[model samples]
Target: MNPIFKNILAVIVGLFVGSVVNMAIILISSTVIPPPDGADVTTMEGLKASMHLFETKHFIFPFLAHALGTFTGAQATALIAANHKTKLALVIGAFFLLGGIVNVFTLPSHIWYNVTDLVFAYLPMAYLGGKLIKKKKS
Candidate 1:
């Protein structure tokens, strides 16, 4: 297979894997930590309406979801790409970062949570993921 094609496929795979991880965590988050009373988390409007009721504990899963998703996706990308593994991994991070930024604008949440999620989740995880691959080669 062509290197360019392989790299493209890696990105596609990374995005899919990351999305799956994120959605999976989100799907189970409610079960693991039930939402505040009357906080309907099923829809965007519901989440927005219930945002005020959320506690710090409620934010944990989302942060894990974002971080783990980016980490796994970047790792997968770095593992599969024909070349520029780290760069491809960062691309995955950039993709998730864009989504995180969009989420900030789309939903109202605590500023501290927003800052933390935006600052610490995506790029750092991706870099770690890429770095892990390097360690394995040594």
Candidate 2:
């Protein structure tokens, strides 16, 4: 198989896996935290409207969803890439970071939550994932 094709496939698979992980966590989160009463969390507008009602504890699942999803995606990319493992992982991170940025703009949240999620979630987790792959290979 061509290395380029393999790399592309790795990226696709990584993104898919990461997105699945993210959605899974988000789905489970509703069960665990249960959104505020009458929050109508099914739509972006509804969620944004309900954001003010959320407590500090409600943010934890989202952070975990983002971080763990990025980590799992980066690790998958690193393991599957033919070369430039770290670069591939970073690419995944950047993709997720862009999504996070979009999320911030689209859905208003607490300033602290926005800052923490933006700063700590994507790149750091991706780097850790790549490092884990490297360590395992070594």
Q: Using TM-score as the measure, which candidate wins?
A: 1
Residue pairs in candidate 2 whose N, alpha carbon or C atoms collide under 3 angstroms: none
lDDT of 1 by residue, 1-138 (tens): 999999999999999999999999999999999999999899999999999999999999999999999999999988888888888989999999999999999999999999999999999999899889867865
lDDT of 2 by residue, 51-90 (tens): 9899998999999999999999999999998888888988
Instruction: Give TM-scores for every candidate, taking all chains together and pairing residue i with residue i.
Output: 0.97, 0.97
**Leading candidate by lDDT:** 1
Model 2, residue 131: distance off in Å is 1.2
67, model 1: CA deviation in Å? 0.3
lDDT of 2 at 104: 93
